[model samples]
Structures are given as structure tokens and as C-alpha cells.
Target: MVHITRGLATALLGFAEEAEPESFSTGLGTTPAREFEVDLGCPPETPIFTHFYHPDAGGSVSAVFGMDFSTPAGRTHGRFVSHPQGRLAVAITDDLHATMLVAVPPWGIDELAAFDRRGARQPLEIVEAEPPLETL
Candidate 1:
């Protein structure tokens, strides 16, 4: 998923640097994610650094499912989802077909569109906060 999203970001933003080749690891041990930091290399088509000038500015997009269907029409559920980690994510289900997160904040959305050189506005829907993870 990270790879695909990374590609999307690059395709849309026109990255100069190649995505840092790294293996995916969801292990439960000491290993941490490196995909999140794929933009700061050399040539400049840095994925992470370029696409996300302020990824943390917005917040994380989270949910139990990928489909972020809104209760109201013409309104994005993202506005309500409490963006944690200062970033957003297009959360998906196990199959990876569905897409809901597309989680991006105001700045990131703007930055991406600008980078595209399309002079387009960023696309973002309201996201409500995700329910608590741990149960009492």
C-alpha cells in the first residue's frame, strides 16, 4: 500500500529522486516503518520530503474500515476524523481495493496540487475522529 501510494504521490508530484528501496515490515518487534520517510535522498524527486512539505501539519487518517462514507451529502468525513500523528492516510481494508483515508490535511493537499503544476485545488473531505482503540 505504501509503495502504491508513494507511486501515486510521485506521479502526481513529479519526484526527481527514486523512492528509497526498502522492504515492508509489519512485524510486532523492534522494527519500525521506513516507508514513511522515503522523500529525503538526493536528486530531489524525494517522495516523503516533496509531497509532504507539511504532512504532519494535517494529521493521520484512521478508521476501522477504509470506506469513509459520510452521513451528510457533499461533505467529507475526514473533517471529523481526529487527525493524529499530525498527518493523514488513505486507510484501506485487507483487500486493498477500497479507499477511504486519502487522508491529507489542508497544507499537504495544497502542496501536492501545486507540485503537480496543475494549479488545482486540494481535495479533502471532513474526517471525524476514530473511536478509541482499546476497550475498558
Candidate 2:
């Protein structure tokens, strides 16, 4: 099993939060933009996110996060495949156009969702830069 030192885990998580998104696509396996499991079922007010497991990647983990400006709370979820050793809680941060999942300790999963919701309280890292023009 590939065990990352606690320090490494923390560093990685921090890096994810600060990393700039390449593309803003809301799909999986797509580079540039990262996607998460978002409750697409939500309206343009409240958003809910979910967790997913891939059970592949040779034990390495992967995830997808989504974001919607229509909702006050950004929702996200996706599959996370990990090594057979142990799974950890993921930290989801709003990247405005995308989201980033920081691998926390296994126990962090319990509070991961909660932290995600709270993270939404702050203004997103990016917002609609300009408003649409009105027709005369």
C-alpha cells in the first residue's frame, strides 16, 4: 500500500486548493477542469454534493467535482478509486468554475461534507466576470 506521510497529505491538499483550473468542463477524465459528484437534481438555489468510489487506478484515488452558480451552495460528488489499504476523507473546495478535492485522513470523510458546505459560505474563488447585456 502506498502510505503518504501526514505531512505529504497536508501539502498535497493545500496544493489542490491553490492550483488553477485549466478547463471548466463538468465531466470526468477531462483535464484542465476538475468535476465532482454534484446533485444535478438541485434547483438554482441550493446545491448538494456526493461521494463516489472507482475501485480502480491500481489503488490510486481519483474524483470529479462540479459547480453551479445558480445554487447558493455548490453541490459536488464523484467516484474515488483508491488502493486496497485505506480510504481517506476528501476536502472539497470551490474553485468557482471547478472544485478541488484534498485528501484528508480516513476519518475526515465523516466531516468532509460538512466542511464542503461551510466552505461555500465564503465567496467563490471566481464569479461571473460580467453581466449579460439587455436588448434595447
Candidate 3:
């Protein structure tokens, strides 16, 4: 379960799951999940970057499932499971298929560099944080 803040979105190429607004309620005391397509904007069979931006904002916790789905339809399906208190959960069932599941937070770049799978030990590059905009 990775917890992150919106500020760290770009660097990690991921999204921080947050609570859904009440407006999304299903009227049956249950909230329906928002469907997500893991489309990186390239051909589905194309190799995705080990670390790249997700086209859509992710749920509180996005699961990284392996590529073991029995059918083509199953492989393409993705959803954000809602949780109480504005949290979300993503289950990673298969490692081979779901290689990366990253969440953004106020994390130090050095901290994430240590987790990089690449053994190159490349120097870490930090992007300066932008100042919050003043309210009109």
C-alpha cells in the first residue's frame, strides 16, 4: 500500500490516490469504481517505460497485477477500488506482468533512487519544487 501526495506526481510518473467526491455516489449506498485504462498512449503491446507518467490520476492505492489474465478483456481491465476515509487500494497479483507500482509523496529523490532496479547507480537528478500559486 503506497501512500502519496499530489505534489510528487510528475517525478514518479505515478498518481496519488485520493478520496472521491460525494458527487460520485451511486445512490445505493455504494460507490462505483472509476474505470482506468492503462494506456500509456502507445500501442498496447509496446514496451512501457519502467518509469513514466500515467495518463490519468490514479486511485489511493493502485494495484500492479501480473499479465496472467485468462482473456484479452481481462488484461485490459483496470479500476480504482475506493476505500473509507478517502483512501484507495491497488492489489498486485503478479510481479512478472505488473512490474512497477509507484506512488508519489513528499519523498526525497535520494530515497527513491535507492529503489531503482537499474544497477547503474546513476547520479540522482532533483527537480526544484514549484512555489504554490497565490490565490486571487
Per-candidate TM equals 0.15, 0.21, 0.21
For model 1, the stretches where C-alpha displacement exceeds 4 angstroms are 1-86, 91-97, 105-136
- Per-residue lDDT value at 37 in model 3: 40
Task: Show the lowest summed lDDT stretch of 10 residues, model 2.
Answer: 23-32
Q: Write the per-residue lDDT of candidate 3 for residues 11-113, one digit (tens) a residue.
A: 3422222322211110001111111142223333432222122323232233345332323232321211222232112223212122222222232332232
RMSD, one per candidate, in order: 17.6, 17.0, 14.9
Greater TM-score among 1 and 2 belongs to 2
- lDDT of prediction 2: 0.25
Number of colliding residue pairs in model 1: 25
Candidate order (lDDT): 2, 3, 1
Stretches of candidate 3 exceeding 4 Å from the true structure: 1-51, 55-107, 114-118, 129-136
| Residue 85, model 3, lDDT | 33
Best by lDDT: 2
Steric collisions counted per model: 25, 18, 5
